[model samples]
Target: MGADEKAQNKAEKLGGKVQEGLGKATGDREMEAEGQKDQSKANLKDAGENIKDAFKK
Candidate 1:
């Protein structure tokens, strides 16, 4: 995976974690769910990148 793509994915995951924590603290289920979704999307992107890298190898 490219460094930029990896960094972006990491940042997205971190942001989602922060959002989830804040949502939990504030008792906002919708926000928490959104955060979880964001994290999942980031994870999927990272997995896709990894697959591409493996194929390149």
Candidate 2:
């Protein structure tokens, strides 16, 4: 994957982790779930990028 895509995915994953931690600390289930969703979306995007890169090869 390109540098920009990688950076965005990393940033999104990091943001999700921070959100999850905060939610756990605050005892907010909704926030925690949202964070998990964000992380999943980021992972999906990363996988798609990897697939595209593989096809280009």
| Best model per lDDT | 1
lDDT of 1 by residue, 1-57 (tens): 999999999999999999999899999999998899889999999999999999999
Once fitted onto the true fold, the runs of candidate 1 whose alpha carbons sit more than 4 angstroms away are none
Candidate 1 lDDT for residue 36: 91
Candidate 2 — what's its lDDT?
0.94
For model 1 the local lDDT of residue 16 reads 95
Error of 1 at 36 (Å): 0.5
- For model 1, give the RMSD to the true fold: 0.4
Off by over 4 Å in 2: none
Candidate 1 TM-score, true structure as reference: 0.97
RMSD of each: 0.4, 0.5
Across 1-48, the per-residue lDDT of candidate 2 in tens digits comes to 999999999999999999998999999989998898899999999999
